[model samples]
Target: MGAGQSKAESDEHFSEEVVNNLSDNLASPDTPPERQSSLDAHIRSRIQVELARLREEEEHVREEIERALEKENLDRERDMAGDETDSGVGQVKSTTALLGDVDELRKQVERFHSKKDDDDFVAARLKSEAVVQCYKNNPSTTLDCWKQVDEFKASVAHLEERYVESLR
Candidate 1:
């Protein structure tokens, strides 16, 4: 087997040398007609064989790449479909929970407003409204509303003191 392989390799090398020599000889004016035509045919056949092999290799690589891309696209589509179903369920649950939370907040705000009728809150609120009215009535004489502003500040301070004492 080794001897046969070496013989084949040597024959290939010899063929290349003959081809090179024949090409050079064919280019000169004194070449024989029969030998020139035969060398030219051999060289052309070798080139055609090599080109066919290269085209086959390129086609094989192209097929492999196309198959890989197709598999990737299928996997991506499957993942997206799964995510859509999961997200749809999650969104429904989250939306209902959010609505319940919003309703609780609205009830809290209503209760706070109802409690605003208490005596101290009403007094502070009334004083604040008076200060706003005074400022509106005397826009150019802002200093004139000092008495109303002072009364509002005193009411707010009293409310703060009561809140701190309740905390203690």
Candidate 2:
């Protein structure tokens, strides 16, 4: 036969086989009334057992979910604590660096003040020598200049005392 004819014949055969199987199943004998009732009771008992097992499985799944959520919460709390600790450490490091900078600035100021004091001392000594030389040349004019020089020297001594006190 041609391929198209053979294919149509196979489709018809398959439909006939399905119809025969359905008719055979439907024509099977029915059970007696007492036997049918007993069979139904057995089926109901099995159904109750299956339902109990399914409920137990569901409860176990719920317990597992609760445990997983508790573990996740613990991990989140730990991560937050670690973050807080890291922030505290960063703050301490920043504070230490700032304090170090302040100490260096104080040292620089002290050095500047020391240099200024040395320059003032040298200038005062030179002025005192010049006044003495002028008195040796002109005694009357030198006398007034000498008095002014003495007053200036006393004020400088007072300023030096205050500077030393500040150092302490």
Candidate 3:
């Protein structure tokens, strides 16, 4: 701007010549030497701020890398253990799961008979999850919602008594 400066050159990396020229363009040449030195200091401070921001970014990236490496190591260890146990990495099948990998690896489950829904039905007065959720969601006044809870418990107990009588 002072002479033949373009927008592109102004955006280039800060150098002594560029910084002085930039300062001179912004301030009159009649500015005192002290003011010029202050401008230089301001430019240096800006550079330091940028450097500090870059260092912090680098530190964050390093922490992420370390976490990733740690996870990878743990995964490798699990894979090694699985290989020894003949499961192989992510292929560790549960004893109850449907696995066709025999040499008869799983000897316990002779059949996959699922239990009847009646077996899961409770006749006893038990707190259902929804009732517990009411207490959890409204911890300050659980006594306020006791009516609904009582109804639910009574309903379950009635169902359970019927189920027991049928069983007998």
Query: Which model scores highest in lDDT?
Result: 1
Considering summed lDDT, which 10 consecutive residues are worst modelled in model 3? 108-117
Model 1: residues >4 Å from true position, as ranges?
1-28, 89-168
lDDT, ranked from best to worst: 1, 2, 3
Q: Ranking under TM-score, best-scoring first? A: 2, 1, 3
Candidate 3 residue lDDT tens string, 43-64: 9999999999999999999999
* Candidate 1 overall lDDT versus native: 0.86
Residue 72, model 1: lDDT of 89
What overall lDDT, based on C-alpha atoms, would model 2 receive against the true structure?
0.78
Q: What is each predicted model's overall lDDT from 0 to 1?
A: 0.86, 0.78, 0.69
Superposed model 3: Cα runs more than 4 Å off: 1-31, 87-168
Report the error of model 2 at residue 103, Å: 47
Model 1: per-residue lDDT, tens digit, 84-145? 77878532223456699999999978866775777888999999999999989998999999
Which model is ahead, 1 or 3, in terms of TM-score? Answer: 1
- Model 2 per-residue lDDT at 16: 96
Model 2, span 92-155: residue lDDT tens: 2234566999999999899866866686666766666766776777886656576657856875
Candidate 1, run of 10 with poorest lDDT = 89-98
